[model samples]
Target: MAYQLPALPYDYTALEPAISKTTLEFHHDKHHASYVSKYNAAVEGTDFDKMAIEDVIKSIAGDPSKSGLFNNAAQAWNHSFYWNSMKPGGGGMPTGALASKLNADFGSYDKFVEAFKAAGGGQFGSGWAWLVVDGGTLKVTKTGNAENPLHLGQTPLLTMDVWEHAYYLDYQNKRPDYIAEFLGKLVNWDFAAANFAAA
Candidate 1:
């Protein structure tokens, strides 16, 4: 199937103070829509045309010859994941098995926040910070430009888009503030929990 742009789970104004409707308009309607269209155009009638996006991503991730396809396909997938990674009133420590896992893996919820924020803050440029299951362990990792856990054989549970377009309009150059808002008031722990359970 040709990749399609997924609609935001909530209204454009739902994210409000943290992520403005204007940002969502440009980011989702323009940027994300471009990736989907690009990926479809790039993959048309190719060997990858019928492959699921995840399969295409894994197959082409590190191949230099497929970099263009990889970038579009991966960005399309990543943006979809990014939207679901947050909810209208989501954030704070998770509960149940996922909560215990975070505490176990990162020592405490505070430590997980530290490490997660560090991963996002430390990413040098346009990229993503991820919470993923790697070898049965929960880890925080970052990838530069259209890259994600799928490229590294990990199961992604949650993600934050640290790309400038993700936060620039609202926070200007203060990415740390964006990351803080994401962790404090926008993260969807239930989504993470579901992913963790399946992982």
Candidate 2:
């Protein structure tokens, strides 16, 4: 099926003081929409036209001949997942199995936050910081550009977009502030739990 821009899980204004409606409008309506359009255009009339977006991304990843398709498809999938990673009043420590797993893997929730924020802030450029399942363990990782854990054989449990466009409108050059707010007030632990369970 052709890739399309997935609707935001909440209203544009729901993220409120952390993320302005204006930001969501541009990020989802324009930026993400562009990726979907470009991805469709790139794969039109090709064998990938009818493939799932994930399959398309995996098929073309690391192939210089299809970098354009890889970038667009990966961005499309990443943005979709990113939107579901948060909710209206979503941040704070996780509970249940996810909480236990995080504690077991990272030693404590505080440590997990430290590692997650560090990975996000340490990202050199346009990229993403991810919490992924690797070898049955939860690990923190970062990827440059449209790269994601899927390409590395890991399952992404949660992610934060470190790209400037993701926060420039609200946080400007203070990417760390954006990352902090996302962790402190915007992360969707339930969503993370769901992903973790699936993984």
Candidate 3:
């Protein structure tokens, strides 16, 4: 099946001041849309065209000749996950089992914040940071150039897009600042919890 852009939970301006409407529109409609289109184009008239984007990423990742397809497909999946990693009333303390697990794993909520921030900030150049369920354990990881937890066998519970397109409008060259704002202001803990439950 062909890929589609997922709807934002709020208006473009919903993330305002912290993340601008202009940024959302361009990031979602332009940047993400472009990735989907490019991936579709790259796979057109091929046997892989009918495969799910996830499946395509898996195959492309292992095949050197399909690197371009992998980039677009992974970017498509990563951006979609990134968009849902937020909500209208988001970013506060996590709740319930998710919070409990976070504490057990990271020592405290503050520590989770510290580690998450470090993962995002430490992500070199264009990439993403993820909270992933790997081997029945929660861990933090960063991927370069559209790579995500899906590249491996892990399940992603939360993600932050560290690509310049994600923060350029609001944060400019300050990628670390943008990441700090996203964690402090826009992250959706409930969304993370839901993903955790699913895992």
The best candidate by lDDT is: 1
Q: What lDDT score goes with residue 1 in model 3? A: 63
Per-residue accuracy of model 1 over 70-132 as CA lDDT, tens digit each: 999999999999999999998888999999988999999999999999999999989999999
Model 1 worst lDDT run, 10 consecutive residues: 144-153
Candidate 3 residue 133 C-alpha distance from true site, Å: 0.7
Tens-digit lDDT track of model 2 for 36-141: 9998888889889988888888877999998888888999999999998988898999999999999999999999999999999999989999999999999999
TM-score for each model: 0.99, 0.98, 0.95
**Over 4 Å off, model 3:** none
Better of 2 and 3 by lDDT: 2
RMSD of each: 0.6, 0.7, 1.3
How close to the true structure is residue 76 of candidate 1, measured as C-alpha lDDT? 98
**Candidate of highest TM-score:** 1
Q: Candidate 3 on 1-199: residue-level lDDT in tens?
A: 6788787778998988889999999999999999999988888888888988888887778677887888889998888888889776677688899888888888998988888889888887888888888988778888888777776999899899988988898998988788777887888888788889998
lDDT at 65, model 1: 96
